[model samples]
Structures are given as C-alpha cells and as structure tokens.
Target: MKKVLIVGAHGATAQIVTARLLAETDDQLVLYLRQSRRLAQYADNARVTLVDGDVSDIEKLTAAMAGVDVVYSNIGGVDLGTQTKHLLTAMQQAHQTRLIFMSALGAHHEVPGKFGDWNEQAIHDFLPGFREAAQLLATSKLDYTEVRPAWLTNTDEIDYETTTLADGFKGTEVSRASVADFMIKVIADPSLYRRESIGLDKPGTDGDQPSWL
Candidate 1:
C-alpha cells in the first residue's frame, strides 16, 4: 500500500480528499493538521495517522513525511508560497518525488470572463503567494501537478473539464468534489499531468461568467 501524506487535512477540500483516500484505497494515510481535534473522526481507523503540526515547520513536516510515497497539499491564504517552500523542502529531504498541490485558477491569469475578473479581485491579496508557490513547484525536480480549479462550488457532482495552461481555462465554476476526485485519480496514477498546471471547470456551465453570477 502507498503511504500518502495530506497537508491541510482540516480544510473542506482536504476533507473530501481524505474521505476518498480512506474509502478507495488501502494506502496508509498521514494527515498533517495544526489541530488534532479536527481529525478525531479517523481515530478509529488503523490506516489513518494524524500528525498535529504546522506545514511551515520543516522538522515536523519531514518527520510526518517519513516513508510517504505521495504528498497532497491543499494549503492556501497569503502565505501559500512560503508554506509550499516548506513542503518542498520536507519532501526533498524525504526523497519523495510525487506532489499534487491545490492552487487557484487565476494563479497564472488563465481564468476568463467576468467571473475571472471578480475571482481575481476577491483573491487579489492572495494571488502573489499562490503564484510564488506555483513558481517553486514548476522549477522543482520532483514530479508535481499543480491543480488550478476555477471559482469552486459545493455541488455533489464530479463532472469537470480540464485544459493545460497554454490552452487557457474553460468554463468557470468547478465543484470542490470534482477537484478532489481529480486529485484521487492523480494519486492512483502519478504519471498523468507530470510537471504540469491543470485548469479545471464544470463543463459548459459558465462561459464568460458563471451562470449564478
């Protein structure tokens, strides 16, 4: 079984990724979170190991990453780029090669329409950090797939479409579950999208602007 380490284990998207990892595979799970209380639900599971600590702490992160085959990071906010450096360092020390990171749609100015404008405006302060983190992942020696999901929604469906950074982003709002599903797929097969930034959106729902907007 693959030993998987998931940072930001307490967040909404990370929670879905955790659930999928638990239900779909026999892989050993390491959840790194700032608070242990948030992951009490997995206390009964023999396969799930919860490590309480900050992602920015290299020593703590490296210890948690021991023998891990894959790393899935879903961290955000203004310090995203800084935090990513920490993750990269820990993974490098552990000699882990595969990394699947969660980044927003506009990190590269790939999103289109009013929704894109609005999304960028809302996250203007956070983009610098995200972009910095993206640059680090792009230049790293490790195999990394930076996930850029557009204007996330809370829908139950997993239907989504994707395009490369060169092709530009399509549609607008993609469900969080869809992004999680895609991450799980990547975990199962790390060969897909190696050293690439993938943009995801719900198919045909939002053109220039999300229908809801």
Candidate 2:
C-alpha cells in the first residue's frame, strides 16, 4: 500500500482528505501536525499514524517523509516561503517525490476579479516565498501538482471544477470538502499529474473573495 504523509492534517481540509483516504483506499496515512492534541478527534482511526512536528523543522520533516509515497502539503501562512523551503529540502534529502501543494489562487499575479485586492496584497506579500516554493517543486524531478483554490467555504458539497491559470474565472469559491475531494481524486489517479498549477472553484458561485481576504 502507498504511504501518504499529509502536512497540516489537523486542518479542516486535511481532516476530510484523511477520512476519504481511510474509507476509499488501503494506503497508510501519516498525519503530521505541530500539535498532537489537534488529532484527538480522530484517535480511533487505526489507519492513521499521527506525528507531532513542525513542517519547518528539517529533522522532523525528514523523519515524517520516511517511506512516504505521496506528500500533500496544506500548510499556509505569511511565512509559507520559509516553510516550503524547509519542506523541499527535507523531501530532497529523503529522495521522496510526488507532491501535492495547496496554494492560493493569486499566487503568481494579480487578478482583477473577486478578492482581487486582498488576494493581490497577499500574493505580493507572500509571493517571494510562494514563487520560491514553486520554483523548487517545478525544478525537482518529483511529480508535483499545485492546486490553487479561490475562496474556501465550509459547505458540505463536492461541486467544483479545475481550470487553467488563464481561465479568467471571476468570484468563484469552493467548499473545503470539495478541495479535499479534489486532492484525493488527484492522488488516486497518477495520470492526472500535472507539473503546472490549476485553479479550483465552485460552480455558479459569485463573489470570489474570501471574508479573510
């Protein structure tokens, strides 16, 4: 069975992805989180091996990468660039490939659609890190797929679409559940592997900006 390590596995999206993997696949899952208490709710999931550690710590991250077939990173922050750098270094040291990174929609340039201003600001502020992370992933021999979602909602729906960077989708938002589903789908099908990044959004949704944006 494939061994998958999910960073930020305590987050909402990670939790859903964990559940789906446990139910649908025979793969082993290693849930990596900074705080062990965050996984209390899932204490009974025998298929899950919880590791309390920080993604930015190379030693800890490398330990978590042992025998991992797929690494799904959903960790984000203002200092995400630093985090990604460490992650890349650890993965490289471990000689592990197959990565799925969850990044924001406006990671490259500013789009004038929904959440444009805030997203632009965020990208501008964090672009250096995001770009660096993308560069490391793109240059690596690893099979990587960067999934960028517009606004994230907590709705319990699985309706969404994947679009290229030039799709010019305006004000599109997707549920966290859908994002998790998309991650699982891509992981299950190696053919879906795309080195390029893609945008995700809910169908028929307007106002693409997230409240926090």
Candidate 3:
C-alpha cells in the first residue's frame, strides 16, 4: 500500500484530501500538524497516524516521514518557502521523492486581465514568498507537482479545469474539493504532472474576476 504523508493536515483543502484518500485508496496516511489535538477525530483510524510537530523543524519532519512514499503539503503563509525548504530537506534525508504541493494560482504571474490584477493586489504581500517556493520546487530534481489553485470556495462541487504552466491560467474560482480531487488524482498517478506546475479553476467560469469578488 502507498504511504502518504500530509503536511498541514488540518487545512480546509487537506481535510477533503484526507477523506478522499481514506475512502478511495488502500493507503497508509500520516497526518502531520503542529498540534495532535487538531486531529483527534482521526486518532482511532487504523490507517491514519497523527504526527505533531512544526514543518520548519527538519528533525521532527524527518522523523515523521519514515516509510512515507509520497508527501502532500497543504500549508501556506509567509513562511511557506522556509517550510518547503525544511520539507525538501527532510524528504531528501528520508529518501522520499514524490511531492504534491498546494500553491496559489498567481504564484507564476500567469493569471490574466482585471482578475489577475486584483489577485496580485490582494496577495502582494504574500506572493513573493510563494513564487520563491514555486521556483525552488520547479528547479529541484525531485518528483514534484505544484498545484496552483485559483480562488477557492467551500462548495462541494468537483467541476474543475486545468492549465499547464505553458498554456497560462484560466477562470477565477474553483471549489476546494475540486483542488483536492486534482491532488488525489496526481497522487494515484505519479506520472501525471511530474516536475510541472499547473493551475486549477472551474471550467466556464473565466471572467475579469472571480464571481465572488
């Protein structure tokens, strides 16, 4: 069975990915978070292992990565680049190569029109770090897929579209579940987007801005 380690397991998108993994695959899951208490509900699951530690701590992260076949990082924020560095180091130490990272759509400056402008304005403070982190992953030799999700919603629908980095990005918004679906698909098929960066959004929703905004 595949052994999957999910960093930042408490995140909204991660919750959906966790459920999908448990329900669809016969894989072992290690849920890594800063607080074990946050994953109390999963403590009793036979296939779920709860690891409490900071992603920035290589020692703890390396320990948590034992026997992990793949890693999916759902964490975000200003320290994302630092955390990704730590995770990469830990994964290297553990001899693990597969990584499915959750990133934002504008990380590559691929978004277009007024929506792109608005998105850049909104995330101006945080985009640089994400872009740096994306660049790191892009240049690294590890098997990695950087998932750049457009504005996300809590909606349950899984209708989504995708764009390769070369094609540019489309649409403005997509459900979190849709992003999770894409991630899970990539995990199941390791050859899907190796060493590539792609964006996700709901089909036919393209506009000057996300509908909600």
Candidate 4:
C-alpha cells in the first residue's frame, strides 16, 4: 500500500479526501495537522497516523514524510507562501517529490470576466500568498499539481471539469467532492496533471458569481 502524507488533514476537503482514501484504497495515511485532536474520530483507524505540527516546523514535518509516496497539502492563510516554502524544505529533506497542493481559483489572475472581478474583490487579501505559493511550485523541481478550485461548495455531487494554467478558469463554484475526486484521481495516477496548475470547476456553472450570493 502507498503511504500518503496529508498536511492540513483537518480541512473540510481534506476530510473527504482522507475518507475516500481510507475506503477506496489500501493506502496508509500520515495525517499532519496543527491540532491532532481534531481527527480523534480516526484514532481507531489502523490506516491513519495523526501528527500534530505546523508546516513551519520543518523537523516534525520532515519526519512525518518518511516513506510517503505522495503528499496532499490542503492549507491556507496569510502566511501560506511561507508555509509552502517550509513544506518544500521538509519534503526535500525527506527525499519525496510528488505533491498535490490546494490553491484558489484566482491565484494567477487566471479567472475571466465579471466572475473574475468578483472573485478578486472577495479574496484580494489572500491572493498574494496564493500566487506566491503557486509560483513557488511552478518553478520547483517537484512533480506538483496546484489545485485551484472555483469557489467551493458543500454540495454532495462530484461533477467538475478542469482548466490549465494557460486557460481561463470557468464556473462559479464546484463541490468539495469534485475537488477531492480530482485529487484522488491524481493520487491513483501521479502522471495525470504533472507539473500543472489546474483549475477545477463544475461545467456550465459559470456566472457573475456563485449562486448562493
């Protein structure tokens, strides 16, 4: 079974990813989060190994990466750029390369039209760090796929399409299941979106803004 390291394992999307991994594959999981107690439900799960540490704690992070086949990093916040660098350092020390990073849709100013304007205005503060994290992965030697999901939703459906770094992002929102599905697919086949910044969105959902608003 493959050993998977999931940073920010307590996130909503990461929760879905981990659940699927547990039920769908025989993979072993190293759940790394700032607060380990958050995943107390998985304490009895033989396949799950929870570790408490920040990404900036390179020593702990590096140790957690031992024998991991792939890393799924679902983290954010103002200091995300710095966190990404720390993760890279730890991964390097562990001699692992494959990474599937969770990013936001407007990360590279890649969204278009009114929806783009809305998205930009909504999260302008976090864009710089997201852009920086994306750029860091783009230039790094690691085999990475920066997952930029178009506004997220708790919808149970797993329906979505993708756009590359060269293409403009589409749709207003995509379900967390859809984003997690894509990540699981990548885990099953690392060569799928090699070294790409992919935008995930539900087809035909494009609009000036998410329907909820």
Question: Where's the lowest-lDDT run of ten residues in candidate 1?
Answer: 204-213
* Descending-lDDT candidate ranking: 4, 3, 1, 2
lDDT per residue as tens, model 4, 42-138: 9999899999999989999999999999999999998899999999999899999999999998889989999999989999899999999988998
Question: How does model 3 score by TM-score?
Answer: 0.97
Using all chains and alpha carbons, the TM-scores for the candidates as numbered come to: 0.95, 0.88, 0.97, 0.98
Candidates by TM-score, descending order? 4, 3, 1, 2
Which candidate wins on lDDT?
A: 4
Q: Judge candidate 4 against the unseen true structure and give its global Cα lDDT, from 0 to 1.
A: 0.94
Tens-digit per-residue lDDT, 8-94, candidate 2: 888889889988898889989989998877787666777778889998789988988999888999888778878888888888898
- Cα lDDT tens digits, model 1, 104-140, are 8888988767767877887899999989998898889
Q: What TM-score would you give candidate 2 relative to the actual structure?
A: 0.88
Q: List, residue by residue over 1-213, the lDDT tens digit for candidate 3.
A: 788999999999999999999999998999999888988999999999999988888988899889888899998898788878888899889888899999998899898888889999988988987998998898887899999988999997999988998999998899999999998998888889889898998998888877876
Error in Å for residue 84 of model 4: 0.5
In candidate 4 the C-alpha lDDT for residue 144 amounts to 95
Error of 3 at 46 (Å): 1.2
Residue 131 lDDT in model 4? 92
Prediction-by-prediction clash tally: 0, 1, 0, 0
Looking at model 4, the pairs that clash are: none
